[model samples]
Target: MLRRLELLKELLLLIPLGKVTTYSSLASLLGTHPRAVGAMLARNEDLVVYPCHRVVMSDGRLGGYALGKEFKRRLLELEGVKFCGPERVCKESVVDLKELLS
Candidate 1:
């Protein structure tokens, strides 16, 4: 289980700057529940290396962030992610899970 969580963090590194993936997307890749992905993300201690902020909800919602949603939004914005609303990320900024598998 610990190893899987570590793998999840490692996967986060694959998300490019200005792009985002969803908890469900990572869960599908890992054969785990999306909640498990969220749980592992909550425990992430090394934000710089893990880049957990790039993960969002399937509907493009910001979801939870260890550093607070606003900070996460700021970070994503700095990376050129455009929001569709106050909390939803623009769909164009989302990366498909298939892109990560390769």
Candidate 2:
């Protein structure tokens, strides 16, 4: 794996199985920029193992996925983490990551 992706793997493992995380969150934890996380995910090769679906927008927007937004939604749907409330905020807990936490 590339250096960035290797770090991304470790960061991904920090995400809970049934919860959704964000690119920004992962980037912060990895001590990189949010765009860097997005770039790394854009190149993700093993979807079934890494479960990239567990990553989404911070506001529960579902954002973009390697395959497509529909894929992202479908993936999360399978994980049982639904968006709720007026804002459609996800009920699943997201680890609040800081830019310098790493």
Candidate 3:
């Protein structure tokens, strides 16, 4: 379980600046459930190093963060991620899962 968590954290690093990915996307690539991906992100201890905030919901909704959802949103905003609405991220800011696999 620890090893799986470690691997998930490493995957979080693959998310580029100003871009985001969905929990389902990460799960699809990791061969795990989307809830498992969210669980691993919630357990991340070092937000600066792991950057779990870059992971959102499949529909571009900002999901929960260890700190807070708004804080997570703000962090992404600082990275230049544009929000399409109050809590929805712009679709173009999302990174394609296939791109991350390569």
Candidate 4:
């Protein structure tokens, strides 16, 4: 559990500036399941610092947001990420700045 906590903690810091990542991608970074990442994010206590809103669904869908789906959308929008296309892929966005947030 401690190791998983560390992984979640580290993954939280990887979210980018003005861009979002999918749950599956994050889980893959830790060699775990997307559901596990989602569970960790859901139980996150340092929300403001971790920025859980930057995580979305792999299929470009906004999945379960512990802070509320609208809040997630608002947060992402503030970062200049907009979902579009028939599948709702993040569109018209700048570069994926994962390095910045990390």
Candidate 5:
């Protein structure tokens, strides 16, 4: 479990400056659950290095952040993550985990 969490953090660090990914995507790629990903992220101590804010819900919702939703939204915005509406990120902006891992 600890190893997986470490790998998850490492994977999260790969999220590019302007891209985002869903929690479900990460969980699938990591062979874990979305809630576990969220739990690990919630306890992550290195916010700047991990870039956990780039993760969202599978449905494109901006999911919770250790810092708060607005802060997460602002960070994503600063990184040029596009939104589909007021609260969801555009589907096109989602990062492909397979491509990233490969």
Candidate 6:
């Protein structure tokens, strides 16, 4: 499980600039639960290196960040991630992890 979490972290690092993904999508790719992905991200100590902020909720909601939701939004904004509304990211800007790994 630790190894898998490490792999998930590595995969997260591969999220290109300006691209974002959902916890559910990542869980599907990793063959784990969305909560597991969230747990792993919550425990991630290296924010910049791991880029956990790139992961959002399935509904495009900004979701949780260790720093803060506002900070996460700012970081995503700097990377060119667009929002659908005030709280959710634009679906067009989301990264498809399955296609990405393929």
Query: In model 6, how large is the Cα lDDT of residue 50?
Result: 92
TM-score for every candidate vs. truth? 0.94, 0.78, 0.93, 0.79, 0.94, 0.95
1-102: candidate 6 lDDT, tens digit per residue: 898888998889888899898998889988999999998999999997899999999899988999999999999999999988888999898988888888
Q: Over the full model, what C-alpha lDDT does candidate 6 score relative to the true structure?
A: 0.91
- CA lDDT, candidate 6, residue 27: 91
Can you list the residue pairs that collide in candidate 3? none
lDDT by residue (2-101, candidate 2, tens digit) is 7778878766766676676787778766777877787788777887778777777777776667888776766666767676742333745455544224
Compare candidates 5 and 6 on lDDT and give the better one.
Answer: 6
Error of 6 at 57 (Å): 0.7
Q: Residue-wise lDDT of candidate 5 within 7-52, one digit each (tens)? A: 9988898888889988888899889899999999999899988899
How would you encode candidate 4's per-residue C-alpha lDDT over 3-97 as one tens digit per residue? 98787777667666777777777776677898988898888888888877777777677787777877777777777787785334464442333
> What lDDT would candidate 4 get against the real structure?
0.71
Give Cα distance to truth, residue 46, candidate 3, Å: 0.9
Model 3, 1-102: lDDT tens per residue?
787787788788888999999999888877889999998888788988988899999999998997888898889999999999989999999997667688
Superposition error at 2 for model 1 (Å): 1.6
Worst 10 residues of 1 by lDDT: 93-102
Off by over 4 Å in 3: none
Q: Which ten residues in a row have the lowest lDDT in candidate 5?
A: 92-101
Backbone clashes in model 1, listed as residue pairs: none
lDDT of 1: 0.91
Model 6 TM-score on a 0 to 1 scale = 0.95
Give model 1 RMSD, 1 decimal. 1.0
